[model samples]
Structures are given as structure tokens and as C-alpha cells.
Target: MYICAFMLILGLAFYFGWSAAYSAWTDMGVYAVSIMLICFGAFGTWTYYNIDKENKANAK
Candidate 1:
């Protein structure tokens, strides 16, 4: 469940970042938001993967 949520956030973040880069860069607020989203998504995805790995290792 947490993994799914992070994945969704990551996906959306990429989409927004991409859009902002191509067209919305002129808007500082939108650009900043996109950048923040991308950073959050990356961190969340990385953290979740590590947690999942730990869980699997302990289960084995």
C-alpha cells in the first residue's frame, strides 16, 4: 500500500516536472512546485524500496 502510493506520487511528479520543464518554466511557482514534487517522489520511492528490502530480508 505504501509502495503503491509512492509509485503514484513518483509518476505524477515526473509528469508534472516534464510538463513544467517544457512549458511552465516561466512560472516560478509552478516550476518550484514541480521541482519539489520530483524531489519528494524520488526520496519517497528510494526510502520505500529500502524499507521493502529490509522487510524481505527479515522475512527470509
Candidate 2:
């Protein structure tokens, strides 16, 4: 449950940032937002994957 919330937040943040980047013509803002989105997305994904692995390990 916690993992899902985190994933959602991170995903939304990334999506909005990317959208803002696309709607604007400035390269700097786009690049910055893109970098942020990538980092957040990667971290969220990693956290979710680790949680799944942990749960499986415990089940076994």
C-alpha cells in the first residue's frame, strides 16, 4: 500500500514535469524537469521492485 502511494506520487510528478516541459519552448526548463522526472521515476520503480522482492522472499 505504501509502495503504491509512493509510485503514484512519483509517477504524477514526472508526468506533470514532462508535460510542462513539452508545453514550453524553453530548453532549460524542459531539461531540468526531464532530469527530475527520470530520477524520481527510477527511484520509485526501484523502491517498488525491492518491496516486491522482499515480500516474495518473506513468503518463501
Candidate 3:
């Protein structure tokens, strides 16, 4: 649940940031936000996989 919420928020932020950067014609903000977006996505995916593994172990 938390992970879903986090991903949703992060996705929204990225959308807004991307639009802003596009309109402003600036690379700096877009680059920074994109990096963060990728990092957050990767971290979230890792956490989800770890959680699933733990749950499966406990189930056994």
C-alpha cells in the first residue's frame, strides 16, 4: 500500500517537473528530476521484491 502510494506520488511529481522543464526550456531541473525519478523507481522495485521474498519465506 505504501509502495503504491509512493510510486503514485513520485510519478505525479515527475510529470509536473517534466512539464515545467519542458516549458522553461531548462535541462538542469529536468535532468535532476529524471535522475531522482529513476532512483526512486529502482529503489521501490527493489523494496517490493525484497518484501515479496520475505513474505514467501514466512509463508513457508
- Candidate maximizing lDDT: 3
TM-score of 2: 0.54
For candidate 2, write residues 1-60 as lDDT tens digits.
456555556655765666676775456665576566566666777787899999999999
Off by over 4 Å in 3: 1-26
Candidate lDDT (C-alpha), each: 0.68, 0.66, 0.69
User: 1 or 3, which is superior by TM-score?
Assistant: 1
TM-score of 1: 0.55
Give stretches of model 1 more than 4 Å off. 1-26
Model 2 lDDT, full chain set: 0.66
TM-scores of all candidate predictions against the true structure = 0.55, 0.54, 0.54
1-60 per-residue lDDT for model 3 (tens digits): 466547657865776767776775456666577667666776777778799999999999
Candidate 1 has its poorest 10 consecutive residues by lDDT at 1-10
